[model samples]
Target chain A: MSDQQQSGGAAVASSPPVGETLMEVTGVSKVFGGLVAVNDVNFIVPRKAIVSLIGPNGAGKTTFFNCLTGLYRPTTGRVNFDGTDITAKRPDIVTQAGIARTFQNIKLFRTMTATENVEVGMHPRLRSRVTGMILRTPFVRREEKAARERAREILSSVGLKRMDELAMNLPYGDQRRLEIARALASEPKLLLLDEPTAGMNPQESEELRTLMERLRTEQDISILLIEHDMKVVMNVSDHITVLDHGEKIAEGSPQEVRQNPRVIEAYLGSQA
Target chain B: MRFLASLRSGRDTVTGMIPGWVLAVVLIVFAVIFPYLVGSGSFLDASTQTLAYVIMALGLNIVVGFAGLLDLGYVAFYAIGAFVIGWFGSQQFPDVNGGKGIHILASDRATFQPKLSGGRLDIAGIHINFFIVLFIAMAITALWGVLLGAPTLRLRGDYLAIVTLAFGEIVPRVFENSTSGLFGIGSTDFSHGRQGITPIDKINLPWSHDLLYSDANLKPAYWVALGMVFFTIFVNRRLRDSRLGRAWIAVREDEVAAASMGINLVRTKLWAYAIGAAFGGFAGVFLGTYNNTVNVDQFEFGFSVFILAMVIVGGMGNIWGVIVGAVALSMMNRYGLPQLNSLSEPLGFDVTSISFGIFGFFLLIMMVLRPEGLIPSGRRRLELREAEIEGSEDTGAVGDMSQMYEVRQ
Candidate 1:
């Protein structure tokens, strides 16, 4: 597809507004044993934009996400989110710093109801103390009610309005959507979706694409997504970063990266 | 149509409410009527003893069930609570000033004397009220829990279990050995030793004015213990439903996931240990008062293992399961084995052999057949069944659920 068509016919009449800079990773390096899982990576993600990080298998896309999200601290370099140094912060701290994420594998509290699962995401947001909870005080009751309402809204937005259903009972596509809804319930300034459309049909992927577009425009939140499907990535992403063997090979608009010979070679060689 | 639909949705919203409310009412009712049904006096005694175990089990549940922390030294807290109370409530120096007593509670009276007879010591000078001693015992035991919990929370699984077991063994030994020289009440030669602190003053009530020392009965003690148990159940239920409780369960289910969500691992784990230890402390006070004696033998490793077994056999992570386990196991230890021994004695079988043999056999059967315990936690039961079914289905190929999902995909 041409660069103009790939922009989804929403190309800026005036230049796409330079939104806030939400995440800035500067020269991050992560070495495991003798091998570099992530080598000297540098990137910037702007607020309210869907930025896609795509690479062939073993490209360290997931590793880089892990470092950024505080699961694995980078051996070198710094990660700044909203003016705070979050490089060595624990995952919970990183999450509390306004970044929420979904795993490549669904990690919903499987036994918990869909609503309860979403409520867990709203854990940091809830303002009930242990003492208040034990006493079942008025404040706790009110806070619980508010949390349930917020959970319901998030679930309904993701098209799983029946919140009483167990998370594992949801079909694959809805589960994926529920995961997104959960991430959103954390009320994060940035949402990291790892293979958000993985294991979904074309129709589901198409719906997710529209959802991404709507979330970007209306939710006032940035998205950093790792997706294997080129069609979905190219369709939704305003910009794309390509990685190969733990190295950032190219980064630009989707059209530019797709046209890059090195990016093409990386995929072709991996397939062979 | 929207109104009717909304009303139906509202009804569904309160789905978890009915059972919870019903259970609460039933428990409250049982607590009120149980004393009378069990013949106020004898039933009270048994119930008081049960209450002590209930509290201890609740505490242990937080560690083993909520946080998945296995502690085999929980009885240490019990020892600390009882000893602290024993030290203060009883006068140890009767012959200190040539037949004049030095009482721990008050040393105002000159005619007060400490009485010692038949290897048991009694303080005739000053006696602290039972309720006051119970509170003091709980505080002392909780401090011990923190002391033990701080160093061991860093250790995981079997290592943690072993360290706690050693601590449990050492605390009572120290208490039994160290009460003589520094205290000046008992000489180095005159240690409480293995026989333990005896002639502990029975619990007295202001209401039972003339009947104060009539009999070491369990009625009043039972009421106090019942109050504490209900209080524990209420507190634990709230903790389970709160953010901290959810964090604890998350850690138990998946520590990595829990940490990823920003839960401070050390803080969460410490809280579990502290809360669990606190319960053990409460139980210690009740136990000391129930027997009217504080003995080192009572808080042994066997008792710790018994409490752990109760948590496991009842159901880990489930409150009701812990209660059921505590009551069931307590009955087995206190009543069932003794009854069996009496019956087997006439049938030409040794009491110890028959009792232990039956106990060991029952435990073995339980492990092999129902590893998840009688009322296994919902998640545990599901995982166990899923694993078993999966294992049986794949006799030739050993592959897990993730691999199966991959193959199907």
Candidate 2:
């Protein structure tokens, strides 16, 4: 753990320049039949920045996240990731092009071990096909071994200790961490986490916040988060975008968004 | 229920006491010497057939068990496999080369087409080596599996099963009706109608001077079947641990998450079908040669269900479990049912006649009692039991609403 911390700290100086755009979302909207879930929302995540997408219930935070991840094709807009026009591309293609996401509902492979889940996230990065796998060629074996090692490293980096435990069998907090670990295994340029600390206690959420920062500083990866916990959003997010009823109500630093009258009204209602 | 629980615990203890590799080694050793141990030729033949079923079950396990794709038409691959051997290893096409025949690496015994005026053996029909034909069967069946699986890529669960079931039902009929021609495309006799293809060449190696084995000696056949089983087990084990295997399991667990992880759903599912079908074909060739016929009557819906039962009973996704399931169910079908026929006088009905009924009942009981299967893989066992133990607390719902709404007292 200390070794990982040291490596993480060492890479801080090498992290990408702040304010450089990593992912650009322009005029993105997702409509489910008659209901407009996300409406003309333009968003951006700067390089090595921790950006949070925050909103109340039914605020279209997840819907916009889905559009960005390619899980839901946007009714209108373009999502350029690291200068690649990845709008409407398949989710796998999106992951391959260096964007990995976690589900709001914790969609880890329930039966697979923590390590196995991470290895699967490394699918796009893996080159071993059927013949190589069946043959267990030297190269494939090496690749598999390296993958297992890397998976272990990623798991530990996310503070998950049990590598062999099934994802479903893990504690709720651990399962959430495992999801992050899985997303990290893809080595994505941008990591999109949906409700990373949904069911966590304050302590667990704090640890996740730290992990998110460490991921940005140490790994030089941009983070796009959909978080319900305001404390976490305020403490960790480099920038915060507030949405309400399928529209972007406010976007700025945590303090700016917190003071914005529209954002305040959207949360506590018009009276407040 | 208590007795069953205790029995399961005891079984687990016994199995867990020995290391897995030791058990595997012992089982393989027993399989290798099985032919010598069994005195009766018919028993040996049945064992060989059982081995063939093992291959088919393992194959089906790849699709239904590993990938979680319910393929009800696995017998289609079996039919294709059997016909591959039937076409390549038999005189099904006597009209090939104007009755002079085409022979490739086939022994003289296999090429009894016609005797020329100079007393030379004039080979007739396509006679490829058994090994080559086995590979051909695998390739063709894999292609067919992909073709059959392509249309069902967008389907899931019952809908997918229904389409596969339709496929399983259609393939045999096509082969059966193609005796005069393939869908009236040509006058080529495909299956020889309901009569099926017969007199398939005996197992002969390209390098061998004579036939490797004949009807009189069943030992060689048993050994060959055992060899094929080993090959299947090896491939299955390797695949279960590899990159592709993980992708299949991930897809099975959750398609959306798997896709999000960058696992290609189309290629992964299709490979499951192809590889699974390839194994079916792998065993089909052996069964065709051993049974001495490629009959459409054998490729029934019940057969697909029978293979599926093996995968389910053995524990879907567990290689050893599926093998055990195949052996138990296959042997019961061959020997146990016939033995039960003696009690038919008292029972007032033939037991063999209601074999599927009995299987269905057994499956019903198994699902209720031990849905994870007889020898479920570690992960699968956990998944089923976990679902039972943990209800909906993971769904973000409060487990204790009373605490959340406690009175001000």
Report the number of the highest-DockQ candidate.
2
lDDT of each: 0.74, 0.86
Q: Kindly report the docking quality category of candidate 1.
A: acceptable
In terms of lDDT, the best-performing candidate is 2
lDDT of 1 by residue, A52-84 (tens): 899988899988988898777788999999999
Q: How close is candidate 1 to the true structure, as a TM-score?
A: 0.82
**Model 1: per-residue Cα lDDT over B1-409, one tens digit each:** 4764575467556645667778678878988777767865654666668778988898899888888888988888888777655655454334543443333333222112233344232434234555666666666666666778778865666899899899989887777776565335535423277776655555545333222322344455567788889888988988988777877876765555555555667777877877788778777766765576788778777788778878877878888888988888877776777787787778887665444455557667767767676667776666566567768654433343222121100
Interface RMSD of each: 7.9, 11.7
Per-residue C-alpha lDDT of model 2 across residues B1-409, encoded as one tens digit per residue: 6986787799889889999889889988988888789954888888889999999999999998899899999999999999999999888888998996777787777555443446444567788888889999999999999999999988776899999999999999999999778878988898988999988887887887477787778888888888999999999999999999999999887777888888888899999999999999999999998888999999999899899989999898899889999999999999888898897868788998889888888899889988988888877887778767776763332333222111110
* Prediction 2 global C-alpha lDDT: 0.86
Tell me how many clashing residue pairs each candidate has.
1, 2
Q: After superposition, how far is residue B295 of candidate 1 from its true place, in Å?
A: 2.1
